[model samples]
Target chain A: MAFEFEYSAKNPLYPVSYLKLRAMHSRLEIIWTGQAENQAQGLAQRVEQEMLAMEREFNRFSEKSPLAVLNLKAAMEDVSVGEDLFMALELSEAFRRGTRGYFDIATSTSCGKDMVSYTLNPKSHSVRFNAPEVTLDLGGFAKGFALERVSRMLSDEGVERALLNFGSSSISALGTHPYGEWWAVGVDHTKQHGIVAKEVRLKDSAMSVSGRNYKGEYHIVNPHTGASVAAEELILVEGRSALVCEVLSTALYAAPKTEREAIVSQYDGYRASEILCGDCGSVSIRKIG
Target chain B: MNRKEFLSDCGKIGFAGVTLSLFPWLQSCSDKAKQEVKGEKARIGIIGTGSRGCFHIKHLVQMPNVEVVALCDNYRPHLEDAAQYYPKAKLYDDYRHLLEQRDVEGVIIATPLYLHAPMTLDALSAGKRVFCEKSMGYTLDECLEVYNKRKETNGVLFIGQQRLFDPKYIKAMSMIHEGKIGDVVGVRNYWYRNNNWRRDVPSPELERHINWRLYSEYSRGLMTELACHQLQNGSWALGMLPEQVMGSGHLVHWLKEDKRDVYDCVSAIFTYPNGVNMTFESIISNKHFGMGEQILGTNGTIDLVTGMYYSDEPAPKGSGMHQLIAQIESGVMSNSVFAGTSWAAESSPLAPGVPIMTNVKVVTGESTVGAEADGSRELLEAFIHATITGRQPEKVLEESYYATQFALLADKAMHENQILRLDEKYKIPYTPLK
Candidate 1:
């Protein structure tokens, strides 16, 4: 039957390439250019849907939900419990291993309470926590994991060639975005405006930069010294997944030069780069892959 | 009553429980309790009062609460005609001169595409609203410049994307958003007309400029003239911009390309963020007429028919025939048409033709349509409302910029035949269209 409108696909139908997706999510304007139209729209829609879904799934305020019940049950055993916050718990472990405890998810700072004090529980799709002294702040890595989830969602939707950027910095370039090479992503230099420190074209992975360059002395809080870690400047990293990029970028920034790579290598697929403030008017670009 | 007793009774309440009654369908509900407050009319001026300009004048005059106050054209004939049609209206030859006049509030530019950018920039600088016609400009840089001027000035600039004003597209877009067809996977916008890019009387000298759509200097061919509008419709509805765009076309059976640098069959693909790909095709060699967006979603594909002859909003059911018969009967009695209806089958009131399919039932036109078609009209009203009461429309300049940027990117792809990168924020900043 003749459809009311025409649903046309472009790319002139190439043999194989990638799909791309982008948004005004992260601090930087994001671009997710990829191949594979067979599942582009469906994939993009699902990514958005699931990102919002996870946010809802973990929100601790809903008292009637399974998360609340699990939180209450876990809290009964210990006033401050960390029984089963899967994404959060795993993030904490990765942070512990990657940062060597500087950016610890388990440790609480002046911002809120520690992960150990985050009375929480999870049963697969659900996670709950008791009224906490420590605020469960997933801001550091949630955006990246959300991006990783989006990447998987695109794959599940049959989109092989895709680039999904959660925000400007946290991005997962799934397939080669039509260039037959890695997607070219520019890392904005911290010191100046419109300055590009480096541009890496990535494939089959993702990259993230959590630095103190622009929003100075803001996000980074060093647990080891109980002082600001990334507060001075940018501590950036890239990886095969969101969690790795997030934790490595955070942990490696504060760790002594000798301990950084060993700490970051614990994760499966991750590489990192850093630019720190120097006394001699010289800035460095360090890559760990 | 006790607290529980009071709460239980609240569940069974009426006006007091009015909100509770809406609990079941709260997420997806429609309300007919609209309070219409009659607002101020939109003021409009027409520049380049050619036939198209006159038509716009006539259309605006017919619209409620809108007044066409001035007409501008280089040609004296159109200026004279404007005076005849609108006795009290001001007239000018140079659009720049028209911009200086305080009598007109906003201007409609139906001039050639090249003049659009400058005219609009002048109008915006002069603190007047603008509604300029399609392809909006001759070059990507020009389009960016004009649009940027609008933003920088914070003046109102509307592109005369009539399809955006057309009801068929609006309805289809609404349906697409409602997920009626489920996560739309693909959208195709195509326009095909059977006409050689040739002269009717073998006058290649003057013919190319008259049918401006035939040459590149004056236009971007089918993509800019026809496909630009359709592509905008797809990209806007999909809510994503295409990163890369490429075009492949041929002269086919048209005039030689030595004189005319326009394509007869051109198709462009715009891939959005989530891999939702939109394809725009324009073929001039065939008459089996077609133009509209084919949106393929997860549920069922929706087709947003727009801007073509057959693509008119699906006419209202039996109301169409009733209106047609009334017209035919009036025509016969009045003796207008040369083609006799004796050979034509009598339209039946008993068994009227089947109604056409569409995504969401929507109406078209600036007043009834969208902000893109009449920026200041809708936008001014909403802005005034917001300023006075702290409430405004959900969409804004950023939204329009996305649509504008999306169209230009795809156009650049067609023009350069290479994948254009729009990675940078406001990468190709120029003056605004407004």
Candidate 2:
């Protein structure tokens, strides 16, 4: 589970540090400055170890993975869950309710039964299924959860200026970049290569982007319809935490334009922006909140 | 009867049917029959003693029936380097002189792209069997001329398409033909590398000659060098050629100080007669995606490079006893439970790939050359066997012709920024020998 890393010298004077690796089928990059080479190496090793542990525990593809096991048996009986899994499930329920059911974990296309068929018991720290066909999938929120955890760990280790990018979809910044006033992150255009549709500055905020149309097909499924969302727009959300940003981005992308503002207003200090592609191939970007 | 006579007689009554029905008979032909058919060792002369030529020499020197008799290169340094390995072999400044050597029965053409067709045609016309490394020619006209000349001559003509002889590919292709993955819906292939793709130039004068792959006059860049193999795989798997191709390419990344004319990135989609599309991508800026071919089918997908086939159907669920054990391991329930509903989902949303040829053990490391050797060595062995036995399979030439045609056409499509339909006249009409 130790992912491959590619390191390159970002600069000679400041000696910027950059490390890239593959996780969850996408590229993850960690860039930082203001630390000695040894300290940076230690921080990178800890980050890699933490990320691998998270992947092992939550990766749904692995047959022996804890998430896979919980998904396999949580419906038949009350399955005793690990603390991490329990916390993730709890956060997922909160996000689902906060987004008015737009951000759902139990309503996966793979789940044949309805979301109401499954129940989580916080008192016993267990999950149970009311029906046999209910299932839970955490792919929508796992990366954000892992990113937030690693960022917190890095902060605790006294690492100050850093950028943790998870697959270019979810990213959290520790502090301002060394060379710039703030971390200047570009939101990639949906159709054009290397085109930045929008740029946002992050001092300590986290951002997540969700789009229904891009390369091949829309993989983001609408939980209410049990079908893929057909909108050709990208929704970008910035918040105080990675989890909230991840949840709101996905929810806003799937929600109608009229309801997106309402979803963003529910959280404090969170804003949402959308880049919509019209039928005639014109593009427009606007802030919804 | 002699092996040639036997095979000739068998060829009259459907070569495919004969190869199938007389499989045991051919196996029973004995060592004496094989020796009688394969009279002498095949002496091979290598043209263009560069990296690819040296690679061929390394494998050919190890082959039992092949003797590396001559080495040819216009560059003295490359010739001197190759001569270190084959000290006994004759060295030539010109390939025509190498072709004139009477002792050499066959030649391996590993020169640059521009020299492939002319060298192959000359070697074939000189009554020497030929195995030319692919992107069969520099241009479509040159490829067509080589094909026509090859058909005219009685000598065996084989292009270096090693994947056709690979055991993994053979097995996967057989399974695909047997409907293991159902009908092929599409094919996707990509090659990525993070390098300048330029060799160190000895001097500025020899830049174009030494780095011919990056020059427009000598090569078609990624399409001819990389996409040909994958395009051939698409055609071979589908048993038909692509009817049209549309593409876009740009020299986006290698633009600042690099003098190369070839595109740093290119992508194309080839449409087959059955409406199935095969997409190809190559990039020199980023190596994130690496390289592989994904053969997508209605029921499954096959990663050709990895030799793994992923079924659309999910893995079977654990049994009731197994589930109970799993539940107990997690301290969920220890006692006998009531018969609950079967909460197990039928199929997973994910695709877990299984190996196509499980018997072939995978070897990892720089020294482990099993996978690479199996394909190239098998191809060279086939060429040598054909030269010695005076029998070359017709399918090799036919495949070479069509694959080169598609590759060059794809290049044209990208350059012209338009869709190109394959002309029937470009198709080499020849029946494949089973």
Candidate 3:
């Protein structure tokens, strides 16, 4: 929880008001650009409220939280979940298969200890654990899920020019910056201070950056080996879908280097860039198909 | 992190009202506490207006709800120079006269090491809050006396341990306490400087008064003057005290012809209760590796001075794709992952160290005077808040006490040329490493 990602607005010359809030144990910032100042302010407040609501609903820390309740009760019997929770689980299941079980929430429930087996019933909007150890921790999926909802909220509210950044990792942009074709977001150099290893331009798209370095050792564990990934590279996935990019970024980062290209290829229109840095801050970026 | 974002993080990271039990002293730093101390001016007096005093004055003059009501010093020039910042303040040649002023509710003592204990005791007895510069005292007994007096008087006391109030340190310590770097194995601290550390005196009679840091009677050499701050790192990161200490000191660089008995170089190794060794080495001859405190752990190492962490586990190298990219960058065409099935698995132990905290200005420990954003201003602000509220910060005196004790013991060990064990009487009730 002490880990934080840095956020920098590439085009500072553009006119936009930033709405900042704390959610999901990290900083969430929304840069809103609109003709009416009052409208934008109102939208910022609504977005903050919605994000806090989602945080409360999905937070595993609170025993009474929806996610916590399901994690606690679903092991014994089929526990019905909310529509949002069900959708998140279904999407996580699809990602699990797509990433060849590399991106799994259940294995991380107890820090990769004990095998995880769970089944999701879409028709009943419920989940049942086949194994007693099959607890679900949605930490890897929550940010992306929340970003998708924020994207929907902005679209329904007729907001076209907005940027949603959750924890500086899960990001979704509704439109381009006022001055440029797309909003320019720089990827922080894994080792060097004040250095941007890569700059990603996003226009009506989403980007997700995942790495085990920022959060300390063994922060991200591989489900296959139940051990932390020792790779120092940062995996950045940018695509049209925030959810897909988020899942792919984490999956590709945790998967073996050989399977990365195949895992990324499973998702359409999504590209993953592996940022490799030498000892002296020399960065090499490898793109996966 | 900026102030706004930092406070937002404090709220979100359970430092707000939710779970301040971890860092109870930080309760005053919360946004809620910020609102509580609003619109309350704290009248303060400066006891010693030298360079360090002037540094505090610079921050004091800029602080809201803080008024410099008095200035005092035996040296007229320093006092007069500091008076320029607060012309309305009453000037006195003696600190006792300044303490007598009813309006001055608190006193900041940035005097010589020998004077810290007596001045703090006097300020406390005068029913005034006290903020004393560190090396709590010239001797361990004095430190204990001053510490016990504060308890008896129930007066507010703040030491010049700025790292406690620094954002990066706070964040790093939070991670450390949460086992981010894993079990702490060793603590390595060193301060290297190239200068003789002598200040220019305007008059021959003022030589001893101006450069008190080089004298044995007025100072405890590098241990008290410099090592005091570094000695506290081990206890803080581990929440346990060193069991014994042994070391050696000698004038390896600056000779005795400079008219100083204090050693120009010294090295000490402190054995903690857990058998972990915390080492301190300082020399005035070289500036390489300027100054740093590294908390070595099983999994990683935290460079507190630079706010960086180097994990022990090396990063596994990328596939042949990285070679392809490097070749393309170097303007060489090569058949890469698309054409090659043969690859080598490689790992590099020299991975680029990740920064523990960003956006905050980290100090390199080169300043003789205080450095900016080094928690000096924030510590002063916290003192002002304490003086206004009439409440003491939690665990501050305990930490200052242990640091002073460590330094004093190290000095004694070096002087005796034998390993010294901590006396049982000095131990206090405190938390231990889990």
Give the number of the best model, judged by lDDT: 3
Per-candidate TM equals: 0.43, 0.56, 0.59
Model 1: CA > 4 A from native: A1-289, B1-42, B165-167, B196-209, B256-258, B306-404, B423-434
Residue A60, candidate 3: Cα error in Å is 54
lDDT of 1 by residue, B1-434 (tens): 22122223222322123322322111111121112223545556788876567656654554454566777776676689877878887777777777787766777788766677788888888888776766566665666677678768767665655443233444355555555556767787777777664434335554754565566666666665566566666555666556666767666667644456677787777777777778878787775655556667665545554322121223323221122223322322111111100011112222222212322233222121122332223223332222222222233333344555555666667657787767575544322111
Overall local distance difference test of candidate 2: 0.73
Per-residue error for A92 in candidate 2, Å, reads: 15
lDDT tens readout by residue for model 1, A240-266: 776677667767766666777777667
Question: What is the TM-score of chain A, computed separately for every candidate?
Answer: 0.69, 0.90, 0.89
- For each candidate in turn, give its C-alpha RMSD to the true structure in angstroms: 28.6, 19.9, 17.5
DockQ agreement of candidate 3 with the native complex: 0.01
Q: Cα deviation of B10 in candidate 1 (Å)?
A: 34
lDDT of 2 by residue, B252-341 (tens): 998775788988899999998999999999888888777778788888998887778888885643322233233323434222111110
What is the lDDT of every predicted structure here?
A: 0.52, 0.73, 0.78
Clashing pairs in 3: none
Candidate 3: which stretches are off by over 4 Å? A1-289, B1-14, B17-19, B315-347, B432-434
